[model samples]
Target: MLDGLNLEVPQGQIISLLGPSGCGKSTLLRVVAGLTPAKHGTVSIHGEDVSQARSRLAFVFQEAALLPWRTVWQNVRLPFEIRNQKSRKTIESALKHCLEIVGFQPNDWHKKPSQLSGGMKMRASIARALITDPEILLLDEPFAALDDMLRSRLNDLLLRIVAESQRTMLFVTHNIGEAVYLSQSIAIMSRGRIAELVEVPFTYPRSSELRSAPEFAAFYGRVSEALYRSER
Candidate 1:
C-alpha cells in the first residue's frame, strides 16, 4: 500500500476510493477503519488521528457476512450485544431505527439469513452497521454481488440513509459508474497509490437528471482521465 498518503474528506460527504482489482482501494479502506495498521501515513477524522480516536464508525465488509445463525434483528443488534444488558432498550430502538432507514419492514426482521434475498441480505448488513449511529461509514463494495438492478436500488437506498443521517462515508468500489452516482468526491488509485482526488461538486439528492448534465460528463471525464493515467 502507499506510504505518505494524505486523504482529506469533508465533514459530511461520501467519497469513494476506486481503482482496478489489485490496487490498494480496499487496503486503504481498512487503514481508515483501523482494521489494518497504518505503517506510515495517518488516517484522520475531524482532524484527529482515527487510529487512537475511538471513532464512532461502522464497517460493512465485502461479503455481507451476516452470521448464518442470527436472525435479521439479531444481526442488526450485534454491535450492542457486547455492551451491558441495561442498554437493551437503546439497542432495540437503534435496531429498529437502522432497519427502517434501510426500508426493512417489520416482518422481515424475524427471518433468518437463509430466508432473505441477496439484496435483502446486503440491506441487513448495512442495517447492522447503522445500529450504532455511526458518524462514519466504511463500505467495501457491499453491493457488488447483486444484479445491476438491485445494486442501483441499494445505491439509492444507501444515499438516502447517509443523507438523512448525515454520516461521513468512504466507500470502496471498482465500478466507475457507481462511483459517479454515489460519491461527492472520488479517489483514483493504482499500484497501491492514489493518483488523484476529483470532486463532483454536485449537490445531492443527485438525480437521473444529472446523467445528462454537462458537469456530470465533465467530472466523469476528469475521473476517467485520472484512472487511466494510473493504469499507465
Candidate 2:
C-alpha cells in the first residue's frame, strides 16, 4: 500500500517523482491517471478531486504508446476521436501548436510511429498528451529511451511546453540530475511511498549555471541523503 502521500502540488508547476528503478514511480503515475485503483488517497487537480475530475487529466506514458497503424496526426487526434467527437479547426490548431513546440516539422506530422526515431516518437507522444489541453499531465520517464544529448534537448522542449501550456505535471524519473533540471519540486519515492518532498526554489528557465550553484549542490545533497536513508 502507498503510505502517507499527502503533499501539495502547486498549480502550473512541474513536480517530479524520482527514485531508483523498480521503485513505484510509474505505478504512482498510473494510479493518478485513474488507470489503476488508488487505494486510500484523494487526488485533487485544480481543487477538484481527481476521482471525480473526469475529462480533466491527461497521461503520457513511456515508449511513445503510439498506435503503429495510425499516422502521427491521427494518433495525436485520438483523444477527440475516441469520444465520438469531430476534429475542429481549433483542435487542429492546438495539435499543430503542440507539435511545433516539441520541434516537429510539417512533414513529421504525416509519418507513422514506425517511421519516427525514438526521440521523435516520444515527441509525438507528448504532442498527443498536450493536444487534449489537459490541465495536469502525468509523464512516465518519457525520454529515457533517448541518448543523453537527446534527452537534454527534450528536457528543454518539455520545459518550454510546460511554460507555454501552463499545465501542472507529475514527472517520474530515475535520473537524479534530470529531476533537478526539470522539476521545481521533487518527491522521492521508496517502496510505494514518498520519502521526501523537496522544493527546488530556483527561478524558471533554470540555466546550466545552476548546475554549479551552491543551492544546486545543497539540494542534490539533501535528495541523495534522503534516498540513502529511505533505503535503510
Candidate 3:
C-alpha cells in the first residue's frame, strides 16, 4: 500500500514515475487515478480531492482493455456512453475527431480490437481517454508491449497530443529510455515511496535524433544513476 506518498504534478507538465518492478509504481498511479485508495494521505488533482477530481481526469492502462465485443468506434464511444451527457450526434462527432487526432481513418473505426495491431489498439485506447478532453491523463506504460519502432512512433503521437492540447500527464514506466523520451521530469520510486525527482533539461518537440545526441546520453546517465540508487 502507498504510505505517506506525497507527490504532485504541475499543471501541463509531463512527469514519469520510474522504478523497479513491484516498487509500487503502478499502485501509486492507481492511487493518483483514484482507483486505489491510499492508506494514508490525500490525493488532490488541481487542488480538489480525488473524488471531486474524477471528472477532470482520464486514465489509460498498460493494456488496451477494450471490450472484446465492441468495435473501435464503439470502444472509443464507450466513455461518452457512460457519461450520457451528450446527444448521439455530438458524441459521434467527438469520437470521430478524437480518432483523427490519434491518426485513425474512418474505415479503421469499424474494426474490432482483435483485427487491429498493437499500435492501433493503443491509439484507440488513447482516443477513448481523450474523448472527454480531460485536464490530466494518467498513463500506465501504454506502449510497453510494442516493439521499439512502434513505441517510438507512439511516443511521437503522445508528444504531439501533449503539445497541441497541453494536457498534464503522469506516466508510469519501467523503461528508462521511454521515460527519457516522454517525461519533463522523472520520479524514481523505491519500495513504496519516491526516492528522487530528476528534471530533464531537454526542450519539448524532441525528435528521434535526440536519442543519439550526447546531451541525451548525459540525461540518460543521470536518470540511470538515480534509478541505480533507488534500486539499492
Candidate 4:
C-alpha cells in the first residue's frame, strides 16, 4: 500500500520511519528487507538490486520470535545452521563477537528463551541479526514491546551497537520519543506515503538527558508537527 514512496537512506546512519499503525511502516521495512517484493519499484542496496544484494542485509522484528526449543547459544547460531561452508572456529568467533556486541554474558548462553527475561530474548534476537555482520540493518520496532525503562536501556545499547558497527540502518517505530532519540533523521509517513523527512540536528552519544534538553523539545515539536500534518 505504499503510494509512490521514495526514500534514500544515507550510508552508515540510523534513519527511522515514524507513522501511525498500519500506515505502511512495517510494510516499508519488509520491502526494504526483501521479504515483500515490490511489484512496481526496485529496491537497491549499495547500488545493487535487492536480488543481488540481499546477502548484505539483516532484519530484526518487534518480537524476538526465537524458537522455543532452542537455547540462547543455539538461537543465535540459527543463521549459521543453514549454511555449512564455514569452519567451526570461524562460526564460533562470529557468534562470540555478535553475542558480546549485544551484551550477552557467557552464563546466559545455555539458557532457553523461557528462562530468559523479555529483554534478554530480544538481545538474543539482535545477536542473531548481527552475527551475519550485515551492511544494512532493518528493524521493525524491535523495542516496542518492552516497558519504558527497559526500552530506553535497549535504545542506549542499540546506539552503542550502531556507533561501533557503523552500519546503515532503517528503523521503523511508532514512538515519537524513540524516533527522536535514535535517528539522525525521521521520515514521517501517512496514507501509504512519506509526508516529510526531518533531520535531528543532534550529535552522537545522545543519552536520556537529551530528552530534557531544549533542542530535543524543538526537534520533537518539528517531527510532531510533520506527523500532525501527515494525517491532514
Query: Residue pairs in steric clash, candidate 4?
Result: none
Off by over 4 Å in 4: none
Writing each residue's lDDT as its tens digit, candidate 4 over 1-232 gives: 9989999988899999999998999999999888998889988887899988887888998999899999999988888887553688988998888888888899989999999898999999999989878899899999998999999988998899898989888999999999999999999999889999988899998888998899889888888888998999
lDDT tens digits, residue span 42-148, model 2: 77776777778857788888889999999998998888888766758877887888788778899989999989999999989998888778888889998888898
> Which should have the higher lDDT, number 1 or number 3?
3
lDDT of 1: 0.86
CA RMSD (A), model 2:
1.8
Which residues of candidate 1, in runs, are more than 4 Å off?
A: 212-218
Question: What is the C-alpha lDDT profile of model 3 across 1-232, one tens digit per residue?
Answer: 5556677788898999999989999999898888987777888876789889798899999999989899999999998888885698889889889999999998999999999999999999999999999999999999989999999899989999999999999999999988999989899999888999888998988999998899899889989998998788
Query: CA lDDT of 95 in candidate 2?
Result: 81
User: What stretches of model 3 exceed 4 Å from their correct place?
Assistant: none
lDDT of 3 at 46: 60
Native-vs-model 4 lDDT?
A: 0.90
Name the better of 2 and 3 by lDDT: 3
Clashing pairs in 2: none
How many Å off is the CA of 172 in candidate 1? 0.3
